[model samples]
Target: MKRQVIVYKMEGSIVRRVIPSDNSCLFNAVGYVMDHDKYKAAELRQVIAATVASDPTKYSEAFLGKSNEEYCSWILNPEKWGGAIELSILADYYGREIAAYDIQTTRCDLYGQEKKYRERVMLIYDGLHYDALAMSPADGAPEEFDQTIFAVNPDRTIGAYESLALNLVKDQQRKRSYTDTANFTLRCGVCQIGVIGQKEAAEHAQATGHVNFQEYK
Candidate 1:
């Protein structure tokens, strides 16, 4: 889908900052919101690794689906992608709540919400990739003037902001903005082998040691 800027009523415009799809989009997205730098993937990976290494019981094998050592090592790899666990850790580390909106499901998963963080950031997950959400002063305003972090409160302002985000997501959904990973076709970039869906892609990768795959319409 073509990149587009969405307006959020009279307050400002809700824009999606397209992050690089280098398998580190999640980290890059988080970095963009936190520091306005999308190239901090390596540093974010180290942050996750150090956080996991510092506490094993809290991030055990049962919860991480792998040993603490293995998980930390895997997370540090630039090819490895971060997900819910990384989001949770980063939320606590940065002392802010993260609200990730899934384009496929229109569901908002709020991490560190129970901790009652004073601020929150937003992200958009399109099945396989992640992008950050920021509010600009105008529909075509420069991103440097965008506001990525928002205050979290019990007042209606927070509710209105969330509503605007949801509406933007719904608008994207109508434009077919998300990838349907379950049915999307992928081609092995290394061997030019055709694969269907994420399950088949993983199987093909494990069987042929081809880690490069690209989605094809």
Candidate 2:
């Protein structure tokens, strides 16, 4: 993928590579940063399922918000979305910190930060989607030549790279790039019933088994 890059104050341009809008966007975004392959979503899902299954105590029902068996099965489902738990597990598995910058709140959630990982990768979360952040050599460089993994100092400081990411996220926020899931209007694709917010969408799905929804402006 060749995306137009955003020039940061640093040497190269930092760009957000848009991941597919499929349900596996989070996994694909992580995979893109880890190995430059977006198609590893299925493999990553399997890894998450296996990792959770291997340790019931660490990933207990109280922690996972569901039974271990059920959570494992649910994570393996293609429609299910990956979140904080999956990010932490994958961060441990890869031995790198995953910094997820939210455009909605301009908050950076660092997974595996406590482990003191030497390397870190960035992901942009727009409330409803995840995109990989990479540093390209130039403004129009190809994504294959971009650098996704960055080094963190032993003292836990990332220097200018982290600032670059946060600035980019702030720019996106200024542009209203994030979806406000709590207030966004959605229409069920199954029955065409209008819904407000993710809570209502989930409730409608549970009550009437309508899972497909599209956001409307």
Which candidate should be chosen as best, given TM-score against the real structure? 2
Q: In terms of lDDT, which candidate is strongest?
A: 2
TM-score of each: 0.91, 0.93
Question: Candidate 2, residues 1-217: lDDT per residue as tens digits?
Answer: 8999997556786799999998899999999999999888999999999999999999999999999999999898888889999999999999999999999999999999988999999999998899999988789888889899999986786878887888899999999999999999999998999999989998998899777788997
Listing every candidate in turn, what is its Cα RMSD in Å to the true structure after a full C-alpha superposition?
Answer: 7.2, 6.7
What TM value does model 1 have?
A: 0.91
lDDT of 1 at 10: 61
lDDT of each candidate versus the true structure: 0.90, 0.92
Candidate 2: pairs in clash: none
Model 2 residue 142 lDDT score: 86
Candidate 1, residue 91: CA error in Å? Answer: 0.5
User: Candidate 2: lDDT over CA atoms?
Assistant: 0.92
Q: What is the lDDT of residue 81 in candidate 2?
A: 86
